[model samples]
Target chain A: MTKELFIQGNQACSMGAIEAGCRFFAGYPITPSTEIAEDLAISLPKVGGSFIQMEDELSAIGAIIGASWSGLKSMTATSGPGFSLMQENIGFAHMSETPIVIVNVQRGSPSTGQPTMTGQGDMMQARWGSHGDYEPIAISPSSVQEFFDFTVKGFNLSEKYRVPVILLADEIVGHMRERVLIPDKTEIFKRVAPYENSSDFLPFKADENGTSPMPAFGDGYKVHITGLTHGELGYPSSSPDDHSNLVRRLTNKTLKNRKDIVSVDLKYCDDADIVLISYGSPVRSIIETVKLAREEGIKIGYLKINTIWPFPEEEIAKLNCDDIFVVELNLGQIVYEVERVVKSNANVHLIGEIGGRLPKPTDILDKIKDLV
Target chain B: MKKEIRIGGFGGQGVILSGVIIGKAAALFDRKNSIQSQSYGPEARGGASKSEVIISDEEINYPKIQNPDVLVAISHEALLKYHTDLKRNGILIVDPDLAHMSEISEFIEKNEIKVYQAKVTKIATEEIGLRIVANIVMIGVITKITNIISVDSAKKAIIDTVPKGTEEKNIKAFDAGYNLDFN
Candidate 1:
């Protein structure tokens, strides 16, 4: 039975992570996302899990990576500034192919603009923030229910793909309270463990599924792992051939399995002339505009992107509509991705703003009205 | 169809809590779908605060209320800021002592929107003997006027959510607001 309860988005996130088999949490307290750490601090220890309030954001993610290497599902969360501080470690996670979940409850930024306000300005940062050409999995939640469910999916995708997964929550969804149905324990997915035999273990060796099994440290496997380019045996290799193979494997693992990582929601998109694309807190407003537009006999549809990365290109391509408007809190981040997916087949418009405010439904409805 | 309701007031006035109670009653107790969201500026204690609760029989697509069908203004400042957004036939409820209703009387008259005044503070202080419970009274009065949810359901929701030892006084406040004559 699904138990229903009222909870804040941050608390739901913590509960979701705990239920997803995440036993380790390391983070610093920051506005809009601090309740996550506080809840984890109390809940983790009670369940025989471990929670550490790290000295800084960088160390927080560092500890999480270390904990993941120790064979535990680990996660860390922060706002814009802390997210920035953790970027190097994020790149480290990407390069090392460590399975970890990072929850970024975004606030208005470019630098501490509005600590308590909500924005989707970090859409691009989530994709390209860590200074690399690696593929990242970022999911945005529009409500408290998604806040709970997506955290579980985030961990699942992280384990399945052996890459970092980001739960891109914002201030609005983080602080808001709503009813969420908690799933049963049996419904949760656990990560696939490494082989039991120590003699045959190759930490970075690819299986038929393109994912390498991770052996926990202190398991007597005598594994050697490094951020530096490594061979199949997990040892640093100076040969150019080894470097090429390691990089290609790390990148292709996510790309080859894009179908498993990407997720989205389409509402009344079929038989509609115009498509409104949005994510996170702004999607709530866009949903309102679509309903109001439909009431006025406007044939409009919506595509709410649940997963931001591994960008759902095939779904957007399938829409095959003439008019598309990508709405977000930033000026033109996700809009570019939509443009790439649609190419020149559709006219892609951008409805956006900056600094602590969300685009209103009337603003979006007015645009859709003009198109129709 | 979706019905959007925005309730705005100071932080401790129970404006946000009132919205939550109504939303819970509709979504859980009454078995109707509802979504509640609140926004407050940096000041946690005393800045302008507002909460919106959207209730519908269908799945709620939008959680934010752009234009509210029923606007409950618990403060004079809220009355000044949000009065213009009420729909043509929307209802505006306010405390007569706190808000100068005559200032927007022309707009209300022109738009045919009903404006009801209640002495929420007076009733909470005199009848319920608690000033802090005025917002609960306002919520009961608003529920009565809008008929969005049954009074019995609202009373049950309030009783279930409020802390122990305060249920009796809150029930009195609710009944006082429910039975008060609206002009």
Candidate 2:
């Protein structure tokens, strides 16, 4: 039986990570996301898991990467400013094919705009913040329930692909308390451990799914890792050809299997004329607006983006709507991506605001009314 | 029909918690779909705070309430800040001890919108000796008047969500508010 209880989004995210078999957490205290670290600090120790408060966000991600390589499922969390600092190491995780989860409880920022307020400004940052061409899995949860569910999915995707996965949650969703029905422990998915016979371990060798079987230290695999381009044997390579092949494999693994990674919740979109695209905390607003518009006799629908990065372009491009309105906290971040996928097939309008505020239902409804 | 509600009050008054509890009751107990969102400026106490909830039978598209169908103001500041956004036919529920009823009454009379005034603080403090449960009292009144969810379901939700030892006092506060004559 599933038990429903009121919980903060940050706490749910922490529990989700724990339930998903994450045994290690490394984080720095920051507003909105601090509850996650606090919860994990207390909860992880009880479950025989390890929790560390690193000196900084960069060090936090670095520690998580180290822990992941040691054969333990690991994750770290931070907000905008701290997320900015973790970018370089995030790129390293992608290159080294490290399976680690990074939770970014997004606050308002170009640079420290607001610490305790909410914003979706990090949507683009979650994709390109690391300054590279790699495709990372970024899951955005609109409700406290999805916050928990997607954190588990984030772990699964990270471990399955050997890449860093980000849980892109905003301050509103992170801090707000709501009832979330927690699934039973037996229903949770645990990661697959490395095979036996430690002497014959090949660290970077891909399985049928393109995921490398990771063997940790003390397991006697004698694995060697570096930030530079590495061969299948985990040795650094200087040749451009090797670098190109390695980067391509790392990036292609996630992009090619996007169909398996992407998840979305569609409401009344099958026969709709207008599509309202939104994610994270803003989806709640979009849901209400669409219902009200329907009462007013408008043929409107909604697409709630749960899997934000690897951009779900294929699924969005298939919508044969006359107009699509992308609602978000930033001024046209996800809207640009929506436009890229939709092209000239449908009219796309950007409904957004900044400075830790959300786009209201009336604004979205008014845009839908204008377009229709 | 879709209803957007905004409950505003000082911190520690349980205004945000009330919004969430109501949303949960509506969504889980009543089998309706709901969403709750809250905002508070810096300070933990005596700060301007408001929580918005949207409940509907169908899928909810927008979460933030621009023009709330129902507004519950527990402080004078919240009444002044959010009254303008109340829908034309919306119900404005206020605590007379914290806010001057005349202003809200005048707006109601001028706009012909419904107004319900409850001496929530006095009832909670004097009768129940649990002044902090005023938000729960207000929730009872709002639930009864709106008929959005049954009283039994609301009580069950209160029982299920409130902390262990606090349930009895909350139930008493809710009953007192529910039985209060608004006519």
Candidate 3:
């Protein structure tokens, strides 16, 4: 029998994290993402884990990073304003190659924007907010079920690559309640543990896959992880070649395996003249828009991105449609990536909405008609 | 088939809970698909609030409800505010003790909308002995009129979703709503 429950997206995310062996949570209460914290507070202790409501987003991310270093699966949840505050540590986590999950429930923003509404405005920030030459893995979930599913995958990917995976959820999916099937614990993925003796192990030493065996702190491993460009021994190395190699490897680890890193849900795009694209809440609206457009005799297909980072360039490059419409709650955040990949092969138009408002089906419908 | 329902009232009136229970009844008990979303803000005791639930035999997209097929308003402000968004000839129900019947009747008569009146608060407080169960009362009224989800399914949903230990009162409130006679 399938274990199913109707739950909000945030709660599902918290459940997925707990199921994925995430035992440590540190976060400050923020609108749109507070439910994740609330759920974790109740469940983590019951499961013999630890959850702390930190003073702010910076410390929240910092605490999660520390927990990850201590060899615990950890995560934090926050919205745009809080996410912005966590970027410095997010970059530090990237440089240090610590595995953690950051659930960013996107809300309208440049700063202190709509707190109560939904926005994908932070899409770019999730990728480039940390300010460095590094590749990031971010997943966007459209519905409540995906919120659960993608979160587990986020933890798994973060574990596999030893990097922070952002589950970029928006407010609509965060708050809405829908059915989520909770699979058996055997289906959940746990991080690989290191078995190397202290004498033979170097904390930051990498194999061919750019991932090093991670040893828990106080486990007799003399790990010296730092944010500065480091060598294989986890010690700061400022030599040009050392810096270049470190930075190049940070980007290459995910970029070289971008094929495996990207996941998308494509619908009816094989014969589509116009391919609609979006992530998060706007994807739901575009799905309906595609249906209404098809009824009006428009051959439209859609590509819903599950993985937003690493850009899913291969899929965008493969689109042979005449035109592409990229809709997002914010003004053309991911659309630029679509434009960059589609280039001259297809005409790309962006339908953007701000103030945390999702574009209506009719809004995209009008755009689809204009191209026709 | 897909049906969209909107429930509206003041903040403390359990407006959102009503939508959640209805959606849960259909999806969990009846094995259908439903999605419920609510308006977000600093809702307080007397402030207007809204929740939308879309139930479908198939998967649901477009989570927001527009031109809802059914509207249940527990306050005059809610009825006046949301009646315009109700589908033409769609079902509209309200608590007559709180909503203005003359305005609703005039609007319904002009628009050819189907309207039902229930004294949900009166039934919940007087008969069910708990005024807070008015939302459950409204849910019962909705189930009786729409039959959107089975009565048994809704009863189970009430038990599953409502706060613990109050299931009996809520079930009775729902029954009072289900047994409401309105033409």
Candidate 4:
């Protein structure tokens, strides 16, 4: 039987990771995100998995990437500063096509701005922070339940695409506790093992799905992995053709599958002219604001971005709205994305905040009132 | 119906845990919708800490508390800081031993707040033989006074939350507060 429990968002993320067959967790304790590592430390060993507290964020991501190669669904959780430190390795994980889950319970940024506060400043960072041209997959959760469900989704996406998936959560969602109904069993996504014989296996070759099957360390396959641009055999090659092909394939795998990879929750958008788009914690306030605006006879719709990366351009572009309000915790990170997609079509407005305060519903309603 | 609650006290007083218990009771056992959030200083103890919860029969869109329907202030600083934010006729639970009621008598009277003076710390230390269970005692007072959560649900939540081997004493502390004659 399924059991409903009151659990924190971070704790749910940990449980979701465990339920998704995550057998290894490597993390360094940081506020807002520490609970994830703490919960996993106690739960992992009991489930026959392993948990290791590395010295710093760099080593934490490194350890998980190494563990993922050993055939375990590995993950790590961190905040802004730690997330910044993990960028180089995050790029490596992308280049190497390593399947791992990185949960960034985002706090204030640019440096370690606020340790215990929430920030959505890492939206662009999640997409472009790793310092490469490769497309990344990021999913943000607006509620504790979504935090649990999305963590599992993140692993599924990672394994399916053979990429590093970021579960982009903020401190407000990370620290808040709510009811989460956990089922007795979860559907796990298993990575495909190479089908070729040992003598004919090409480590970097892609199947029809645009992702190569991965074999564990002791799978008796000819596997040579490198961060440098590699060919089908997985050996480093300096040839321009090899580098372009590798990068294009890496970027195209996510771009071509954007429809399947991206999801949004649209409410009352079919008949409304003003759509409010938001993700993470800000979505809660937007939902409340939409309700209040509708009660006042104003037709305000809500478009919540569940998948933060690959940008959800199609959904934003299809909205025939007069105005679109992009709400986030930072100073206009995702607002620009809205502008880029809805260029000259609708007025894009930004309701951004900093210093740990959530964007209030009253304020959001007031903005909608001004527009109406 | 939606009820917003805020529990405030110094750190190490289990202010956060008390809120967690109330929320857990409502959400897990009573089958209501609840959201619990907390804010505290960097210090592990002594600084003013607060935990806010919103329990609703319907979906809770905004996870933050606007104006508290019930404010549980267990310390002097907590009472002084949050007394004005209570809604009219809202239930206010305070520990008389830690927070002096005389300081906020004017505001409490003006707001028509129903104040319950629970000596939860005294009962936990002297009667229950454990000061750490004072929060559980306060949870008992909250359950009985507000009627937001059932006695059985609150007790089940306490058992589900508190550490092992101490559930019995914690329940005893809860009974002490629940049995207090406020009439």
lDDT of 1 by residue, A237-329 (tens): 899998887787878887888787788899988888888999898898788888888998888899999989989999998986789999888
Question: Tens-digit lDDT track for model 2 on B1-183?
Answer: 888899998888898888877887887788887878788876779898899888888765445677899999999999998998888988988898898766656777777778888988899999899888888898888887788777887898898878999999999999988989988
Docking outcome class, model 3: medium
DockQ of 1: 0.42
The residue ranges of model 4 lying beyond 4 angstroms of the native Cα positions read none
**Candidate of highest lDDT:** 4
Q: State which candidate has the highest TM-score.
A: 4
TM accuracy, model 4: 0.98
> Least accurate stretch of 10 residues (summed lDDT) in model 1 chain A?
A185-194
Please give the C-alpha DockQ score of model 3. 0.77
Mark the regions of model 1 whose C-alpha exceeds 4 Å error after superposition.
Answer: A196-200, A267-272, A285-300, A355-362, A369-372, B96-113, B116-132, B163-176, B179-183
Candidate 2 residues lying further than 4 Å off, grouped into runs, are A5-8, A38-42, A53-55, A175-180, A185-192, A265-275, A284-303, A319-324, A341-348, A355-357, A360-362, A368-372, B103-105, B128-130, B140-148, B179-183
Q: Quality of candidate 2's docking, in CAPRI categories?
A: acceptable
Candidate order by DockQ, highest to lowest? Answer: 4, 3, 1, 2
Per-prediction TM-score, chain A only? 0.97, 0.96, 0.97, 0.98
Quality of candidate 1's docking, in CAPRI categories?
acceptable
Residue A184 of model 1, lDDT score? 77
Task: Please provide, for model 4 over A1-372, each residue's C-alpha lDDT reduced to its tens digit, 9 standing for 90 to 100.
Answer: 997879999999999999999999999998879999999999999999999999999999999999999999999999888988999999999999999999999988778777877898888888989886989999999999899999999999999999899999999999999999898988878989988898999989887778999999998986887898899999989999999989999988899899889999999998897999999999999999999889888888999999988889999999998999998999999999899999999999989988888988998888767766
After aligning candidate 4 to the native by TM-score, how far in Å is the CA of A207 from where it should be?
Answer: 1.2
Q: What lDDT would each prediction earn against the true structure?
A: 0.85, 0.86, 0.89, 0.92
